[model samples]
Target: MTTVAYQGEPASNSSTVARTLYPAGSELPFTSFEQALDAVTLGAADVAVIPVDNSAAGRVADVHHLLPESGLFIVAEYFLPIRFDLMAVSGASLDRLECVRSHVHALGQCRKVLREGGWRTLVSDDTAGAAREVAELGDPRHAALAPPAAAELFGLRVLRSAVEDDPDNTTRFVVLSRAAVPAPHTGEPTMTSLFFCVRNIPSALYKALGGFASSAVNLTKIESYQVGAGLNASRFYAEIEGHPEEPRVELALQELRFFSTEVRVLGVYPAHGHRRTERSG
Candidate 1:
């Protein structure tokens, strides 16, 4: 059986994605993202399911910094609709709850409920961990904001369901493996993720990105981050909506490489169906 690694307790969003992707696989949870990625790198696990960003919370993990340094390649992407529940041990009453606990992101995502309740907040390492803590505390005064599955996992009762501030909140997760598995260029929707550093010269970034404009390539996302504590250079992580093997994409990359000091293709995979669904909606 396959062993899937993720950075959360069972029933956390990452765990849910891993289970959905590999139902028969065994799950291995780690305390941190780096540990989960390391498991895949050291052959302890086949792959790691990691959250990259959330529509409500912005970035969940520092993937831009972590991915480049981990030497892992993205194999696939999954979009999960986020849902948080207010849960506590059996016999806990919503009216009696005085404090809320969850991962920082979960607390942030459920701001509407938190604001209405006006409860004190405590940040835990992960949502499931918060649920487990609530269960262990056995206090009706302390409730947790956690995934629905987490309520069942830790035997906590759901006092409120789907408490996220935004009904359409979603998180984007990436599957990482130690080796590259670029999807075949079969003309379907595809996403190419890459990292590049432009040479430190006047208009270097502008020139580096001009190729995409000239080639009519659609860049879905681009974000620049400082590297090595150096103000003179910056690294960019970009996602473009085409396979690198395509002619126009190839031409754009050729131009990009000419102006860049370094360039690395992180992954080229089939775009998630959610991308189309989201756009059409």
Candidate 2:
């Protein structure tokens, strides 16, 4: 059975998505995204499922900065609906709870419930990990904000369910493998992920991206961050809605390369059906 690596304790949203993608696979949880990616790179796991963005909380900070250097390929994508529950030990009461703990993102996303309760906020590594800690501590004064599944896994009682700020809260996860497995050059929908660094010339970015507009290639996502400590150089991570082998995409990439000092294709994989559903909705 394939061993899937995820950045959280069992029952975390990442783990939930991993199971969805690899139903019969064993799960290996890591404390952080880097460690999870390391597991796949080191051959300890078949793939690492990492969350890139959340609808309510925005981008997962760890993933955006780590992916370019991870030396892993985006093999697939999965969308998991995010839900947080207020949980505590079996007999713990909401009135008696003094402190609430969870991942920073969860705490931020569920600010409404936390603000209403007036509990001291504590940040933990991840949501499920916080729940496990609460269960192990067995303190009536302590509660956790995590997924409902986490309450069941950790033997905690749900004090409140669906406490996230938005009902449409969802997280986008990407499965990474050590080797490149580009999507077939066929008629099906696909996405291409790449990293590039443009030159320090004036209007370089505008020139580089002009081809996409000319070619009618849709650029779905683009993020730019400084490389190392260099203020003059910046690297970008982009995702476009076409396979790299396609004629239009190829021409666009050719134009992009003319203005870029470096360009690396990270992956070309099937776009998750969730994107289509989300767009239609």
Best by lDDT: 1
- Evaluate all candidate structures by whole-model CA lDDT and list the values in order: 0.93, 0.91
The Cα error of candidate 2 at residue 128, in Å, is: 0.7
For candidate 2, the per-residue lDDT at 204 reads: 93
Give the runs in model 2 whose Cα sits over 4 Å from its true position.
none
Position 63, candidate 1: lDDT: 86
Which residue window of length 10 is worst by lDDT in model 1?
Answer: 224-233
Those runs of model 1 whose alpha carbons end farther than 4 Å from true positions after fitting are: none
User: What lDDT tens digits, residue by residue, belong to model 1 across residues 122-225?
Assistant: 99999999999998999999999999999988999999899999999999999999889999999999999999999999999999999999999999888889
